[model samples]
Target: MRKKRQDFHFTGENNMIRRLVATLREYIPSNRGYPLSVDDGFDETALCARLEERARKGEEASRMVRLREEKRLGELFEPESIVKHNLLKMVCIDEGCMPPYIVQSESMGGNAGTWGSFPCVGANFIYDRMGGKIEHFGNIQYAPRHLINGKFAEGTFKLACKIDFHSIPPSTQYRVVKTPSFTPATDIARQALEETVEQYNKIYGINLLR
Candidate 1:
């Protein structure tokens, strides 16, 4: 008798493994570039140097972005760094990328379907600025939100994300207790969006709106 294939559901552990693998893959450069191997008398030192130089150039090129990290992550802009590049591109929301389902925002987030032309929520990246399990982030909420009166709403947005500056080092992930930053979203309509944010946090485990 033929056996049936077992179906697997992606739980937290599976998701973590997927993210860890995805993160490691970034540092693994594509071998298609170098043609010479040991059989061709390749120099290990020269190859390592070439890889480093290529990675540095790639890192520098991506710094065109203007993120809120300007006040914090100035080191990444330096001429030398792999960590900076890693942090910048850590969250992969771009389409057709590896583990493409990992989302950094509502746009990249999974859709529960549409609600009267509005999109509903499905799955999303649960980032713990205290640097927890979630590695995917867009940092889109760092901007301040404006109220109808054109006043900058600070505290409400302050309830948003928690960026653990401490965990962004060579070791450790997130500790749950550390400094947090607020990613406020601007409402062009200039309406009070506190309730909206709260609901979003409660439903999707997002740091915003709560």
Candidate 2:
């Protein structure tokens, strides 16, 4: 006997992912400039040199100023964390997710006001594999830490993810499917998700399978 085919439509969560992906596509080209690598192209010496140059030019010398300056300079050098923070803010506002808050730390002394939280719910690309294992990529809830004033500094809330957005294909679709009960509701939904992933993977010359 032949099997029946299922029709799929984007669930509310999946639709949100789609929007987030779209926003990323629009934002990356102009803002990020290039793909991120293992080191994320971070160069402490170069960053310090640039900061020193700015200081010599009489730019604001506050610790927060320096931090923001580092963030701007690292836009291309350390794109992952910076890009993650940027996308998280945009997605939070667009999806009405929890607003990001600034973290306070006495260790930061007067610069505590510069730290910001990372509080998004899930990965931008999530799915369930066979045998009930859940997999995901491009998390929105990642916080990047830096050494400020010789102190190892971090935000108020910190969440970590293995993969960053720059590592994933630009055309990659975003979802939040999980195992067991949270899997796609219908066969159509499963097929749609699988097909989208496959299509983008082939086009972008990458494999997302595990």
**Which tens-of-lDDT digit does each residue in 38-100 have in candidate 1?**
333443444444555554564454443324333234543453332232233332223211122
lDDT of each: 0.31, 0.31
| Residue pairs in candidate 2 whose N, alpha carbon or C atoms collide under 3 angstroms | none
TM-score of each: 0.23, 0.18
RMSD of candidate 1 to the truth, in angstroms, is 19.1
lDDT of 2 at 138: 29
Which 10-residue span in candidate 2 carries the lowest summed lDDT?
Answer: 152-161
What's every prediction's RMSD, in angstroms? 19.1, 26.0
Output the TM-score of candidate 2.
Answer: 0.18
Model 1 CA lDDT for position 178: 15
